[model samples]
Target: MNRISGLPRMLAVAIIGALSITALAQSNPYDKFRNREYSNKGYLSEADELKLAEQVHQELLKQFRLVEDRSLNNYINSLGQRIARRSQRPNLPWRFYVVDDKSINAFATLGGRVYVHTGLLAATRSEAQLASVLGHEIGHIVGRHGLENVKRSQKYGTLAGIATVAGAILGGQTGAGIGELAGNMIAGGYLMKHSRDAEREADFLGLYNLRDAGYNTGGMVEMFEILQRVSQSSPNALGSILASHPPASERAANTRREISEHLRGSDQRGERDSSEFERVKPSAPASSKPPRKVRPRN
Candidate 1:
């Protein structure tokens, strides 16, 4: 009777072990793509991606002169929050920072941090125009453009060196010499190219976010047109924005087509442009120097 009882207990333990293994397998998000072509390429565990983003965020804070104007910061945050609420990752801890530089630029990181140069804000004429730029950056984050590019690099086995540089950037122990190296690494190459599909998707999503946030979608077209004109006059002037993405004329055209065809005759009255926007514009810093070569890290 004792032996027979022990046999049933052993059987129960075996069944439990099997279920545990199955659960572990099912819980892995990347398992489904393990055998796929790009599965192994650029395969950063979600944990790594978040870690990289946090490290990059810290680096950004340390390297750039972050704006300290409370009202301006709050205003940008409010606009970002409204747009984020309409984004796919609404629950993310999104942050908006105003860079003190005068370059007309904006960028987004993987973990929902968006940086906008003061110059860009100064150049914009209205809240909707600003929203168009923010919407584009938001599009990059929502579309996971950086991750896709990293994956492509991984697929080609070219990401290992890049990942090493990224690791060094994140580790924060690199001395001044290596700091320059890492900065050069980030600003020198095409490590963060968003695919054409990703670009188009962001364009559409940006317009959607702008409209949802009660801004005029036409502002999207206008912003791109401004960028296009700037690019043609001196591509160097819009260095980071133009290089990381495609030509603004193409984007403007596409946006105009979408707005006309899809959102024809939409109401645009009563949209509130934050009063802070007006007050902050004149106070923003201007970049007197020419456009420097800065590689964009998505």
Candidate 2:
């Protein structure tokens, strides 16, 4: 009889242990690394991600000057913040910068840092288009692309080099040296392209993100169309985005399907453009500026 009683206690212990393990697995907010889940922070801790983002942000400022206009910054921030608020990592203190380059591209780094080119701003016909781009970038962060890159790159090795440099930066490395290294990795031509799976996930996340932020999902479709148009009309003007991801046509097709399947019946209304976007867009032109008028040519 005593032996039979012990067997029940043993069974109880085993069941409790299994349940505890399941609970722990479920409790972790981040997904398992290999699962390709959106909102994954990947292998990097949040602190490390922030440090890398700071370094990258510093490098971006050094390589491409940011627009000095406060109004322009505020306008981008307002929209970016709206999209980010609906993101999985809504509480991450996000930062948005307008790169002075008119190159028709935008990218997101670690933490919540995102950069938009002046060319892209000029190209977008509506605020919704801008939100689409920004939402895609936010998806990258919420998906943790930069950290994923570090994990996958044989050359980076958890970025041992960056760790050393980052330590030095915390101590004595000048901004220029760090900027050169990071700029080469980013702007100078060494960007790590995200996988097709990651790209598709970003598009999905971005699509929903805009809709949740009350922006029209159609904006994402239009943005993809703009990318396709740019790729066909001026391939060289395609910039880093196309170089890093799949073709715009594929992306556009996917967005159309998503709208059909998920968002077709929804009545979520979002702003297509704001007075601020209209007022500040002139300051962020694509390509080149028109020549100034000469008063005394006659």
Candidate 3:
């Protein structure tokens, strides 16, 4: 009789242990990202992305100085939009900005916002090299990298709570806490961190964008060399830009292999430089001020 009674208690214990394991798995914030397909856009709709982008833009205005020269803005927009038109999401309200900072970096955020530091423009050897950098950034948006990373980060319970605050702000509601969370999310680099696979995918897509848009594919390879050189000489210049990417030599080698194996004719056929690029390049002098650097969360 005692054995039979103990069996019921033992079965109950087994069930309780199973329940505990299930709960722990469910609570794990990163579990969902492991098996996800990042090819498709993440949970946010286009409109929602734009709304979030607008908020982030406001936060950026507080952090960096933007070039206000009409001619410079128009030139970058025209070049960026040309490459953007060849992307998977061509109709996005594509906009580009020249950050008046002397850091060799460029980054993209939600809703087609791309920022290139003055140092990056000053560092390029030709229009093709500049366009290659622009294409790489556009490739990230084409793959919805930023949005997917943001969604993954949102799975953390406390950070998940920030979504409700984000929604409230987007829906025209306001609070100090809501605004603060939104700013912290951007300032903290939550939206900029990407996995190695994502970085590789962007490089692949960027090469295609460069090719399809009539620029020499070799520019992508050259851009990698420039990046590698700067990284070796002045490590701080790249800051967070190269932190999550593969080593520069590896990237350049891969790009060259891709060009030789698949995109053979592209390296030789396209335009290598442009007069317009020369006109706009000199205006982007490196700033005397130090750039704002933020350590990204892993």
- Best lDDT among the predictions, by candidate number: 3
| Ranked candidates, highest TM-score first | 3, 2, 1
Question: Global lDDT for candidate 3?
Answer: 0.78
lDDT (Cα, tens digit) per residue for candidate 2, span 139-257: 88888877677555524554435545445555655555665556656753333467776777777778878899988777888888898888889877767765567788888877776
Q: Report clash pairs, candidate 3.
A: none
Clashing pairs for predicted structure model 2, backbone only: 214-270
Q: What are the per-residue Cα lDDT tens digits for candidate 3 across 187-255?
A: 778777788877877787788889989999999889889989988898788857754688888788878
What lDDT score is found at residue 291 in candidate 2?
Answer: 24
Comparing 1 and 3 by lDDT, which wins? 3
lDDT of 3 at 172: 68
- Evaluate model 3: give its TM-score: 0.79
All candidates' TM-scores? 0.70, 0.75, 0.79
Best by TM-score: 3
| Candidate 3 Cα deviation (angstroms), residue 32 | 20
lDDT of every predicted structure (CA atoms): 0.67, 0.73, 0.78
Rank list by lDDT = 3, 2, 1
Where model 3 places Cα greater than 4 Å from the true spot, the runs are 1-41, 158-161, 169-178, 288-298
